[model samples]
Target: WSPYKLLTVFTFIFQTASKDGEVRLVGGQSSHEGRVEIYYGGQWGTVCDDNWDISDAKVVCRSLGYSDAVTVLLKAAYGAGSGPIMMDEVACTGNEASLMFCRSNGWRRNDCHHSEDAGVICKPNEDESGSEVEGTTHVLDRSMDFAESLKNLYETRQFCDFNISVKTNGKESETSIICTHRIILLLNVDANFMVKDGAENFTLTVDEECTPYVDDFIRYLYIKKISVTLKSSKCIHKLASMYGILELQEFCSQLFTQLLPEDLSFQNQLSLYSYALSTQDTMLADSCLQYLAWNCKAFAESEAWYQLTWDQLGNFLFRSDIVVPDEFFLLEALESWILKKGPNSPDLDKALIQMIRFPMMHPEQLFQLQFNFTLYKSHQDLFQMKTLEALEFHTVGFQNLNQYVDLSNIDYMPRIYTSPTWSYLLSGSSIYNQYNPYYRYDYQNFYSQLRSYSSSFHTPKHTSFLFQSDMIQWSFAYYESAQSCRNSGRYCYYDNYPVLLLSFESRPSSNYSIQYQNKALMICKDSYVSDIRDFKNNLVVLPSNDTSSYTFPCSSNFSYQYVVRPLYYSEFQNTQ
Candidate 1:
């Protein structure tokens, strides 16, 4: 026979007859149950579940020193194996000393995949209500003998003939040298070790950054476990990727997927976010972005925030989901980024400046930007136009601006504002009785009273309110009802049931409501939150009155916020 065929035959015989062959459970919840695998042919491999039963499980459990087979688990109950399917159609008579002694299709001769890998759950010795004491003791003794033999073999370096050295480069390079057995290297390391003319020694070079984690990687080859924390996950994953350890890389990916932003410090969060972007780990990157969005003030001062590229900064600002204590912080952060970038590209700067939601800023905030802000002074013409648009949005209510401006503009939309000036109101799902056969006049009211505003209400009843803006007084009424097509002299309505209607009238205290005083005033429907962002069109901005009252259409499961901020418009205009 050829040398390769002879070697295969010798391996088959040794695996079937050698008393020194080892067995272990892997990927189990506990030690007593998992996929059944045997150590032979200088490697570990799974057993096929063909014709596998409790009798076969008994022999496997006896070999492992377990009391008895609790049950035979088939089709890889614990987890699928990744190695070769070594044994198949194992038949045990429940009297064999070991699974090795049982009949099988033969080693490495199975027509099976890892999906068919077998598993077992063995009864613990603690359950001894009525058990065989002497037989169990004998099995335990044999297991101890096998363990002792392996320990002795490992310590004495028996059959070991290869030397492997791992080194990391630095100013003073550190090296780890191992006198390894040929079988250990071939089984644990990689398939490259399976050589015809066995080289006496092998050397591997590692990156200096991965030096600390290299030992842990080496230990995993022997113990099959490694410690991973947020701090070490990156390094260990890097080492695993470098060595093409796909299983270890998969484990690290799972760890990253389960991570939350609060699981790491802010600095570590930023570092991991950058790492996730580089590695294309979208889940982890999104979690970090959520944390950053909520903690806008904290991220604004962070060194990492300053280090973001212009594209990164622009993308972050473009997100409409960013919720801060106030929108002014966003403007300030952008200003800081602009100053850091210098005055090289005015076109790029203009593109980024348009991302600012100037209409969302408080009136006082806009006043400060138009006058006191240095960036605004540097680009007076651009900011002056933006400031004028925001001023128009404040002076003319959104409903009035619908004729002149495209309300679909993102600048006209409001993010979730959680400041004191903004008030949130949610209508319960149970409150609406719309388009129901047995519809009644039943309604639920949500009333929110704040310092600047008295009450915001959601009710089906048609209610009119007479309120004064800090500048002028206005009267408005809004209600929801089921209506059919009708002609009312001026216009015809064709839409059917469930419509919200509003009527507005301006009653100015003075003849000149449009006169620009030192202070500008407008009521903003800050945000309308529903499954769809289109709910924003329903926002009814009620001017500030002594007893300000605002009403919403009584629809199920909807929320909105409105804020009234002090608007300041200066009398002096800076000459460009």
Candidate 2:
């Protein structure tokens, strides 16, 4: 029978005969719409259905092994019923029936109750194996094993491949055959089958229930999960490696740059430059040094440089070395740039002053020039006097008289008109007057005698001053006279005195004013002062109309004294 007929047979048996708790078989059909009989209580019966169609008859005929079915009928009772009808008023269409028995709609409507419900039965051709058999027989019985049965079926059917084997009850079962690459018929067996490796297992099933496709679906899931995992791990590793390398480079570069500037300060720029030039990885160091040079030069010319001393430079350089090379180079470059900008710039002068003290050949000339200017301004008069004294006292050292003296310029000799010695002489005995005579003197003879005496003596060429014991003693003896002359009056009379005097007048007291007397003192805190010679006693306070001025004496020991009188005023007012 066709597979559709077999399915109809099973469905009919499950729906009709099985519901009655009996096992019965239905056969002997002719057309697709064939009559079906049921045996109940040892009597054969027919079923009648009013609502019936060719589709219902087809199912009945196919279940009974007929080729096809055409029509179905229904009635109150089966027509010509001589036996007991299991169910009357059977309702069916072409879709009803089973190979076990034709199905009937139980207890349906009836027009005439006296007529027996009857159904027609037809016989198919005797040679047509599609016809139903009379009684129960072993239709599944076969001598061939399961494998042989499956092979025979596959040979008979061009659309099937019986590659699988079935074993039942310790013997091969001839139960079913499967179509290749399509249906997998597992007959009454509970066992897993393995498809060959690399072969695509498309479908998996157990007892006709579809399950997961074996090869492609499972492999796709594994591949997708694994691929994602591998890619994420690789990305994380790559990122970690990149970050670690970058951080290492940054740290190394920082340290390298910091050490470079010190090499420059030590006049080892060439060594540092060569080291950087030789190393392929010294780009950071090179850039740093170049920047340092430029910045430091700029800083040297700025006002901030002037405020910075050598000690401060040492501290800054030491601290900067702790940073990375790149940072160090950038900062050094900025500093060098500042230095090069010059002293008028902020702090540049102070920095240059500190660096100038270092004994380096390149900067020595510049240092000397600056030193010369400062020294000239600080001691210009002393130098001038020394020069004049050297020329006068050492005239005889020159053998050439014309080169040593200009006799024609007699008026050039300093006259005694403003001399303190002359003033003293005028106030003293008359013998000083004859010795001084007039302002006129024989400068030619004096210059000739001085030259002759100096020519007879010998001294070092660089030594401009002649040291004499008598001259020293005489200068020391007149020290108190010089000091007295300096403090004698409001205005200083001695130009040679080192000290300068300044005074201010106190205001007169008034009835509206409150007078409180106090004193202010200025103490030298520096260690340089050892005596009054090193001290500035020039700052003085004097009472109005008084000749005497208060002086704060210099002392090595701890001492305090009143230096200035109280500040006095007629009235107090808030200017702010």
Which candidate number would show the highest lDDT if scored against the true structure? 1
Number of clashing residue pairs in every model?
Answer: 0, 80
lDDT by residue for model 2 (1-576), tens: 443333234322212122221222233233322245555444554544444445545555565566664344444222344333344334444443342233332212122121334343333445544545565533442222333433433345544332332222223333232333212232211111223332333232222111112221222221211121221322222222222332223223333433433332333333334444444334443444443333343333334443433433443343211111122222333335444544353344333233221111112232343344443343355434433433453333222423544422311111111112111111112212323222223656552111000001111111112211111000000111233433333343332222223222222223222222212222222211111111113221111111111111223221111211111122222111
lDDT of 1 at 364: 69
lDDT of 1 by residue, 316-343 (tens): 7776556555667778888888887677
Evaluated against the true structure, the overall lDDT of model 2 is 0.29
TM-score of each: 0.41, 0.19
- Model 1 stretches astray by more than 4 angstroms: 1-165, 171-174, 177-205, 218-224, 241-265, 274-284, 302-304, 340-344, 362-364, 385-413, 423-576
TM-score of predicted structure 2: 0.19
For each candidate in turn, give its C-alpha RMSD to the true structure in angstroms. 22.2, 54.8
Best by TM-score: 1
